[model samples]
Target: MAKLRLFVDRLSQPSRAIIIFCLANGLDAEENLVDLGKGEHRKPEYKAINPMGQVPAVDDDGFYLFESHAILRYLASAYPNVKEHWYPVDVKKRAQIECILDWHHTNLRRGSAGLVMNRVIAPALGHPLDPKAASECEALVKASLDTINTLWLNEDGSFLKGSSEPSIADLSLACEVTQLQFLGEETKAKILSPYPKVRNWLDAVEKATSPHFESAHEKLRTLAAIFEQRRESQSSEQPAAQSDL
Candidate 1:
């Protein structure tokens, strides 16, 4: 068997997501934590692996891959006997789950990225997000959640593929939504509250991806630590006026 290496950034939702999937499936991937804040990802060494220098990259033997969801699907497909719930066996059932994953990348991920960049990163760097941009981002996230709750996650069906257990789609969505906490307390509550079925699904995701998947508290703490360092660095880099003695 070839050695598996994961080039990840703990603070990245997608990166943490890959971590969960690998651990859930019982594979011990060698993790090389890439620190993005300090510009470590932009270096030539890491860039050779992923030209875009994005986190959540996987290197299996000499083959390199990016995009968190793609990596996850590849893992599940390669290890068919590991966990059936990771990826459904039936063709139609698998397609059904993929529909949700597509919806997540298009809607949920875009909206949540806006919230995270504007609310978390901008502030730490001493710039505030424009009111209109923030408002639009918030509305989009809420609307995406609403659609997930009412359309796909109807009360009649239990999971995305109508399975009692979670699928890869749930894992992908959970990874992105979990990062919303970095936006703020009020934002976190609002995004999580309105949808009953979504909340239930979230609980199922956490339960299904057990011990290896971080507890909610652990995720938040990790983000807080990252942002705190960001704030400290921003504060230090600010220019101070000098007075001649």
Candidate 2:
């Protein structure tokens, strides 16, 4: 039997989510890194796997899949070993999880991804930082966090939608929050400070997911360290440049 082939770039939140899911479920999956920075995802060979040319596509034997959410649902349904809490068999429970998943794309993901792109990625790609755009994104992000704190986060449980265990929705959103590691520590704290419940829920998800969660984020952690170092170097150089003026 061919192992599930997972093509991913760990720096991507969704990719990390998929990796963590597979590892946590103990699926026999082969991880194939697709370097988005080098445009490997756009190559014809990779396109043959996913026409959209995106990282985090999967080939489970001959069946191919793209989009992290779809892939997660498929894997949970396909593999009998996957625990029910991750995506329950019960209709009501599943539907509740589905609702959160749907809301995530337009709300949490939009704000978080937009902020990361504007504040971190755009500048790395040689584009000037857009403070106005980033500020807009930050507002949306805070709104989304408030919603999660007040709505989705259950008082009865540690997970989303009142579930006692972590689900696919939990993993997805938790991974999205982890992307804020790219931001300056102070900036990240300011964004999260108002929502202590959201922060606690994130910690619960991490604890539930355990070693796999941390392992999957190893690349992100490494890159974040480098990003911080680079930011400090640039800041130090700025004063010297101004002094010479």
Candidate 3:
């Protein structure tokens, strides 16, 4: 069997999920870093691999696959020897997981991506933050959290689908929501405070996928630290500037 080649930028939530899945399952894959910052994904070479030029693409020998969720489902189906909980064989259970993955794209993923792009990526790209857009995205995120807390999570279990074990859906949603951790503490709290279930689910997911989860998110953690330091510097300088004035 050809070793799967994963083209990814860990900073991407979906990419991180794929990385965690592959590592957690012990899939035979080689990591191919595509630096979005360097526009590596946009180059002609990579565009040929995935015209959409997204991270979390996979090449199994010559067979190419894109879209993180698709890749995840393919991996789970192809590698049946993996733990059953990740992608169960039972028809209803598998369907439920699929349902969550489908809902994820338009709901949780949309808001999370928007929040991160507006709050973090936009600033890095030298674009001013759009207050309206940020607010709207924040609302979407909160709404998604409400639904997840009230509906998706099981009353008896720690993961989605009411399974004691984590699944692909858990990894996907967890990665999506944790994007908020990149924001300042106050901003993060504002977005996360009302949803204790979401917070607890995140903690459970982190515990279930640990080490690998933490490893895949190193870049995000670093970015959060940098943002915190920058904010602190600006805050300290504000008083000095005011004193001089």
Say which candidate scores most in TM-score: 2
Best by lDDT: 2
Instruction: Write down the worst ten-residue block by lDDT for model 2.
Output: 236-245
- Per-residue CA lDDT of candidate 3, range 162-243, in tens? 7899999999999888788777666777778888888888889988877888888888888887877776777687855412
| Tens-digit lDDT track of model 2 for 178-237 | 898888666787789999989999889889889888888888888877877777777697
Put down candidate 1 lDDT per residue, 132-152, tens digits, no spaces: 676688788899988888887
Better of 2 and 3 by TM-score: 2
Instruction: Sort every candidate by TM-score, greatest first.
Output: 2, 3, 1
lDDT of each: 0.77, 0.88, 0.85
Off by over 4 Å in 1: 123-128, 155-158, 215-220, 225-245
Better of 1 and 2 by lDDT: 2
**What TM-score would every model get versus the actual structure?**
0.85, 0.93, 0.92
Poorest 10 consecutive residues of model 1 by lDDT?
A: 236-245
Residue pairs with clashing backbones, model 1: none
Cα RMSD for candidates in order? 6.2, 2.9, 3.3
